[model samples]
Target: MSPDVTAFGPDFPFGYDKWLGHPAGLGTIPAEKHGAKVAVIGAGMAGIVAGYELMRMGLHPVFYEPGRIGGRLRSEPFTGQTDIVAELGGMRFPTSSRAFYHYVKKLGLETRPFPNPLTEAAGSTVIEIEGQKHYAERLEDLPPLYREVAEAYDAALEEGARFSDLKAAIAARDVARIKEIWDPLVDAWDERTFYDFVVSSEAFRKLSFHHREVFGQVGFGTGGWDSDFPNSMLEILRVNLTELDDNQRFIVGGADQVPKGLWAHAPAGPMHWSPGTSLKTLNAGAPRPGAARLFREGERIGVTDVWGHTELYDAAVVTCQSWLLTTAIDTEEALFSPKLWMALDRTRYMQSSKTFVMTDRAFWRNRDAEGREVMSMTLTDRLTRGTYLLDQGEGRPGVMCLTYSWMTDALKMLPLPVEKRVALALSALEKIYPDVDIRSHIIGDPITVSWEADPNFLGAFKGALPGHYRYNHRMYRHFMQGEMPRHERGVFLAGDDVSWTPGWVEGAVSTALNAVWGVMRHLGGRTERVNPGPGDMWDELGPVRLGE
Candidate 1:
């Protein structure tokens, strides 16, 4: 467990944390470019991060958000209860997300270990699969079959991907070694699915079919990943290699506070803005209406809000889900190359739904007659693929995410009302905890989210499919606009979708930094010689290009 193993890329291994912490600051814009208005579409993590950096660099970032400012980092509070919240979006944050935690530390927000399965924070875990239920305090306490499944997956990673060596390389930040092992993996696994990798592995070949099934249901980190079986093996490898799933934590107040904090936080000494100037004040306390249309306005980029208010910006960073450009916003075709447009359109997003309920207390902590806790953090093959119990501490109300499912499982509840969804989840939990009366402990209206149903976000986050590496490479490298035609250079993309690892806040934060670099360079600004940005290291450390 080397401290340096933080999401220092398997693709494009640029140290974003170091870049952000550099005393020289991000970069300097020319006096003429000072106060230049840049339209940041969608005030999500990426948008806020990019806007915050741009503002620090003497640029004025005018945010256009259709919905709330926090985007997918949504934290919905229970009715009449401000402190308690349902983390409808990114609830878990891994310590490896050095760049994301940079802001978290800056805001002085408190965090505690996420109660992932088999961890001390979870206290206990219950695994239910194929109608069989098992309770355990840790992996060792589970049945032998469970241990065999876990070992087979670990052996499979080592057999196929050389897991140990590669993880060590990442931990050491050995740039050449990382690319040496990872570049070939991209070529080998990009065209294959995760299920393909698991089934084809020599290690799994030695195990029973039941073992593989268990591996999918009770994954190594977090919970089930069967929903992601059809995704590119390269995608899964990136998550494993970077340790994105392990050592997870959750924000104390809420995940949304990070973005909201940045929105109101003014840099100690911004280049052009006054000392008290902040993004909140820059936009006069609220963001402009959601961007309805994006088009080129001669040399500048023009953004039309939902209210028909059009404004031109020196540069624009589109931080919303890439699909929104096609489904929600009317983006001009000329702004992106045909190949780039294809990538943006082809970039697949995963569907996700979460049903949460506020509870009377941390009642799950009570032990039953058998001495086992009344309820535990749950993973199952039932309707509730994963159930998390969030303890707000003794004497305080707790929150329970009754169900967190993805893809097929998530879509099953897409059309159902919140009440019906809750009922369905409770029914599923009842089967697992036969003696537990979950509904009796309920305290408030349940909260549910079907990300795909929202027009602003066509899906939760990007989940690359087999043979989609070219698309991902195209989107990820778009920030290096030095080679691009002038018309397409000013408008940039930033979000988890445009990053190597989607569905992680680190991706959003890292790509946002890329956009900040792109915008700075687009505006005739340059990073200090002492601190080169992502764009500055593009040629040597950019993602590998695969043949057609």
Candidate 2:
């Protein structure tokens, strides 16, 4: 960030500022008349872990990222010519995550460890069904009505890996039993997207009963999507005994050094990072009683911006990608309620893409033999999107890899035309390596984030279907709605859509440690309610049916 952020003007980095740091159970708010004036909105990683717990309570928080800050879990700046870190975007971090390994041991950082970056499955992953292919290698290789629908897709991923003791046995006002059963069993097993779960699964099987891209050749790790499974079998059972590939590490240099270390202890002139400035509207009920202003992208919220510049802070925590709250901004009808803006206008998102290559593990030890895919493979090709293993340690032979593109909503929107995005990355690399020969290492061309072509992160992570946490837990519970009791004091709401497990990064660091224990119970701090974790992690794909 050395001075040249697009010749300045929302380009940031001339001492690139962004303020609002301090979290780890918050501590800072102590300067004025109810001085805890936060504003946080998408600097990613759930607005950098709820702007580091609202600038450690001495509250003055002010982040607002329109772009760049580890949202797609980025990592570029082409480090020292390749020991390989060019992780152009998020992948591998689910090492069982005990509170994301205590936020990487409270930011000392370094989670490098891997006994098996998943190199096992070798053959038989063939499935087509009606059109006919089916091969079978395990779940009785289907055909008993697809092995009773592959035992109900491994009992919907073992009831989406046992819901933290049914969300610590509900009763947070019965979180409506996560809309009558953990949001449709986590969108019918891992956040919906197939013509939106057409009752009793018409098809899309394969959870290690082979074929249907052999769980994308045993690699494309993440979970749910017909049944893709193998984001390293939940990273070999979340890496370290309940999640640990050394805390799925990242951020020694980038992952935007976690909101540049929460904008280096933020708290100055309420944060703002304009960037190609955009947002345009969101007014919501006159100028008083529960406020909400915004404006910027094409102006006019407070007549082209200014309720004192989009109302600084009496209340406004946005933190983007709530389906960009229905395209960038604008919802009126009192900013919320009409059943919360028709549940944030039918909120839906799940389409992803990530490509970064520097290659030279001798191009995966000469692809086959020699190292026969030294582990981590998955590439059954729906335009080949999950190819893993991005090296970090050992005599390092310059190898960094990541090409995720899982269902990238037909090429993520916005002004395209670099030769039609290099012919859609040469037709998604001829549907994944068809006789190789992609005119020499391709380099730059595969950047199609398509979370519905951004109206602001309109869903990629944080999906949740079915009853989706009982009707989108009030759009990720942005520290619950107001009625003024000092507008719900110490306000909080981390993301990955407030959890009972929302789209991962361990439910955005377990909803930023449940908003640093709700701003330490609004600075009178005290929490004793964890009851969520492995707890019989999922008694192997069996009981717990409640179908109604």
Candidate 3:
């Protein structure tokens, strides 16, 4: 009921006539030409949002998803009741993601206020010592030296309400309050991702006691620290490791269910999905039979495949792994060079392991003393690559828990056989939740995502490196073009990687919305689309640029 008119305000779906053009069951019907037929590659949020925009313009879109519809926007329904709806990809976001809010509301979907979980938990901070982890009520328990500096530094950082998140607690001397609001590092989408946040943040400079917890590198003091990782890599590690944000909301079932609902409601059009398929090449020069540019066709880009397999399209888009986009051919000058690709590789990524341990629910379901959902316990690990929980929708129990979401600077070096990657995940879990009855508890690990080992994605995402603020600005400017603030269209690129707000659902949504708006404006007759204010962080800093 609520989504019927998302951005339409108060109540929506006002008049379908105002929104739909052309004819009924006919956005897909070909008529004249508006110039070029758009081709969106990669099926993730960026690609999907682009496709959705094209269809809304009375033009058809041939959504090309080399894999399933959702990219990192996926779920593992295998363990069914046990798997706990593990979202191995983009997690949740806050009201800060304006486009997401508009999109959800415009679609007229049900909306619920997400109750913050950190409320009930007695612990909001954790520290790691010599690989061992422990939680704390106040950061005071840390070594006297760090406790002195960090506390002093933490004392100064303020969150003005106008600043997206206000830090009244810092002024009020409320440890619990600050825990709920402040992030040690800035959240910016830059080529430097998390790598840039660390060395640059004010908090890290003051607090060095829990360096591992703050920088999150596996074996930091070890040989893994190389002259190679001087700037971006080390900086990203520091920022992401120490940065934190907890504003939250989620759909009823698994997160993917929300997108599925969107698709089910989309006006009829050409939607293609081939999960096991891989894009061999992007035949740009050598012409194939039929549509020379099926990728930009009406609705059926009848473009031929590697072996002369042809297909049609009204507007075709490739929504496969982004690395594939860069690695489409065997030529040296294909998309990006191997060194460039290798440089891309050294960027950053997220790795996770989830074991949906189904327990006799209803037990942990009780609202705590303060009317909050009880969180059994949360143990922080210095080496938890990249991990967190996806609050399943109403009525669904069990934790969609996670582990080890990190910028894989060190991991890329390890030679992981498929079995080893799987084993590493289990081992990491064993360390986190030692109480689980290994054989009986885990129902055969229904799902595991070792992006490093997966040849397709190379790595899940690219973390923001040092000085990413500059790089991000350049990317967004170069790609989103319009008469507005920051609009770069022609080279439209969207992904968690491109969005300096790396390793989270927020960036993905951020990337998609901008791209969607750009596509719409290109076909929005003559009305220019506005660059949705850089939501939050508008005045704080511009997109990270490379050379200052």
**Clash count list over all predictions:** 0, 37, 71
Q: What ranges in model 3 sit over 4 Å off?
A: 1-31, 34-37, 81-84, 106-244, 267-307, 310-322, 329-357, 360-376, 382-397, 400-402, 407-445, 467-474, 480-491, 517-524, 528-548
Per-residue lDDT tens digits for candidate 1, residues 1-548, read 45668899899999999999999998999999999999999899999999999999999999999899899999999987887999989999999999999999999999999999999999999999989888999899998998888888888889889999999999998999999998999999999999999999988899888888888888867998799899999999988888888999999989999999999998899999989999999999999999999999789999999999898999999999988898889999999999999999998889999999999999999998889899999999998999999999989998999999999999999999999999999999998888888889999889999999988887899999999999999999888898888888799999999999999999999999999999998888999999999988888898888997
Error of 2 at 315 (Å): 10
RMSD of each: 0.9, 20.8, 10.6
Clashing pairs in 1: none
lDDT of 2 by residue, 25-135 (tens): 222233442344455556667666665554444344455554666676666644345224555545455444444444445555555432122222222233332234333
TM-score of each: 0.99, 0.30, 0.60
Model 3 residue 298 lDDT?
34
Per lDDT, the best of the predicted structures is 1
Q: Between 2 and 3, whose TM-score is larger?
A: 3
Q: How should the candidates be ordered by TM-score, best one leading?
A: 1, 3, 2
Give the candidate number with the greatest TM-score: 1
lDDT of predicted model 1:
0.92
Q: Model 3 Cα RMSD, Å?
A: 10.6
The runs of at least 3 residues in candidate 1 whose Cα sits more than 4 Å from the true structure, single-residue gaps closed, are: none
